[model samples]
Target: MTELALLVQGLLDGSIYALIAVGLTLVYGLLRILHVAHAALFTLGGYVGVVVTNETGSFILALVAAMIVAGIAGMIIYRLVYQPILHLPPYVALIASIGLFIAMQEGFRFYDEQGVSYVNPPVQGTLELAGQTLQLAKIVTFFVAIILIGGLGLLAAKTRTGVAWRATVTMPAMAESFGINIIQVRYINFFIGSALAAVAGVMVSLTTNLVEPTSGDVWSYKALAIIVLGGLGSMRGTLIACFALGVLEAFATTTCVPLGNIQICLGEIMNRDAIAFAFLVIVLMIRPQGLFVRA
Candidate 1:
């Protein structure tokens, strides 16, 4: 029962990671930029959502507003910072993003100088699954992730913007020859990715019921690891890796192994972040392309 509960919790956590990683992977696929500042967008979402919830006492409103704000911010960043460097070397953009990340982190620190922040879920209760109880907030988050991902997947497949994005990434010259506006595609993709990250921020805050200014920095690194482990540009790989890592972290944190009449607490030996990177190293060595990437 304990193992089952741990697995469930791990998968739920993984879902959030997957949500965050999807955005990171998508942006990478579109522009090949690391977009380190993406983390700040996540933190911004949480801060905005918390403030909105506090002022209006409406979780749904807060969620929508946060996403909109973050999405717009993402577009603005791309236009002001990335667009100017679009033709420059990738490393140049990477450096710019790093600077942007630090600036946004400090901005959050200045604004949210209060103590820790948290958001309350709109509904309460738990669902029993396979004799294990699941928090309503987690369930909502899981469903929301599935719905958003699915919708995005469909949009990518069917919409003109989606088709243009794929074509532009596949062959920028050919896409441009066909009159596809790569700039517009980039803007749309960045907006979608950033908005998704915002949703992840809000969901994560609801699940943990806590938020700090550093939350973005923490999850941003983990999200980067997730995308790398899942394969840089493969959405399917990212999802698979995200849950696998999540479950692995859960097991590490919760499962105690017996060894010759003694118990070993894996979680104590290495924290979740450490466990994630350990898996990352092994995966990189064994399968440099990632768990889901096939060469």
Candidate 2:
């Protein structure tokens, strides 16, 4: 029962990780740039959600507002920041992204240095599932991730927009030559990716019940690690790697081993974030191309 509970918890956490990392994967796949500022957008979403919820007492509205705000911010960032520097070396864009992330963090701090908490979370209480207690919000988060990610998959596989996106990714020049609006595609990519990140942000803030200026700091790097470990820009690989990391971290934190008269607790030895990076290192050593990248 304990093991089962851990597994369930791990899967729930993995869903959240997928929500956060999928946007990063999409942006990287389409733009070939590490959008460190994507973290800022995540933080921005949380703030928007909190403020909107508090002011209007509507969680659904908060979600919608966050998505709209973040989506527009993403398109603006792409046009004003990334588009101008994309002709330069990739590192240049990376540095700029890092700078933008830091600036946004500072901006958040300036807006409210102390951070904020939800006035009234929409979901409260726990649920009994398979003899294990679980937060209702987490369960909701899991289903929400499923629906959104699955919807994204369908969009990519079935929609004309998806076809255009794939064409742009495969051959931007040819896509443009064929009358596909490359600029529109890029804007749509950023908008969707940023919107997804925003939704993830709202879900996370709701679960935690707090929104801090530095909430996005950890994810900025961690999401990068997830994407790289999953094979950079591989959507399927990213999903697999997110779940794998979530389960590994869950086990590391919850399980202890007896060794030579001394019990070793993995969580005590290393923090959760450290465990994630360590796993990434071990995986890279074994398969440097990443878990799913074709050799």
Candidate 3:
């Protein structure tokens, strides 16, 4: 039962990672832009959510509002900033995103108060599941993620907007020829993707109960790794890659092996769960098209 308990915890952590990764892949697949600013955007959502929750004490409303604001912000960025660079070289656009990321990072100093220690919110209730204790937040997050994934999958597979979005990925010019508003679709994609990131950010906040500007950067990198590992533009592939990364990170965290009577740290192999990113680099080197690219 103890072993089962640990396994449950690991799966819960992986699910959160998977949610964040899906958002990252959405931005990459739909916009074809490596949004370095996404890290800042993620943190922004969490901060906003925290503020609203504090004032009104409505967690669900705070979550939704955070997503809406972040989504609007993303759309604004796309229309005002990225639109101008759409025709530029990929590397040029990449550089612009880096600039935005840096600016947002520095901008957080405006919110820094003197001597306010970060205190994590205490929603720490445990549930007994089959004689094993598990965190309620983690379990709720996992189910929410599963439902969202299933709904998004259906949206992509069954709806007109989803089809349009997929068509754009397949061939932007052809999608435009079919009379779809390319710019509008881009805005929607950006909005949804960024909103997803915000949702993930809020979920993460529940885990630590603290909000910090730098937190977004950490989540973004994790998402980036999952997006790359999942094979661009394939939602199922992205989910698969997320779980794969999650399991790897979890294993590294929960276990350590003896090497020649020395207890070598598994984290040294993958610190803070960043081994997944290293694996992504190797995968790209070996298969630039991605290991799970949709055929």
Please identify which of the two predictions, 1 or 3, would achieve the higher TM-score against the true structure.
Answer: 1
44 Cα displacement, candidate 2 (Å): 0.5
The TM-scores, one per candidate, come to 0.92, 0.96, 0.89
Listed per model in order, the count of residue pairs whose N, CA or C atoms clash below 3 Å is: 0, 0, 1
lDDT of 2: 0.89
CA displacement after TM-score superposition, residue 144 of candidate 3 (Å): 1.8
The parts of candidate 2 lying over 4 Å away from their true place are: none
Q: Highest TM-score, which number? A: 2
* Candidate 1 runs further than 4 Å off: 115-121, 128-133, 258-263
* lDDT (Cα, tens digit) per residue for candidate 1, span 233-284: 8888889988998899988877789999999988889988988899999889
Evaluate all candidate structures by whole-model CA lDDT and list the values in order: 0.85, 0.89, 0.76
Best-first order by lDDT: 2, 1, 3
User: How would the candidate models be sorted by TM-score, starting from the highest?
Assistant: 2, 1, 3
- Assess candidate 1 and give its TM-score to the true structure: 0.92
Superposing all C-alpha atoms, what RMSD in Å does each candidate have to the true structure? 2.1, 1.4, 2.7
lDDT of 2 at 53: 95
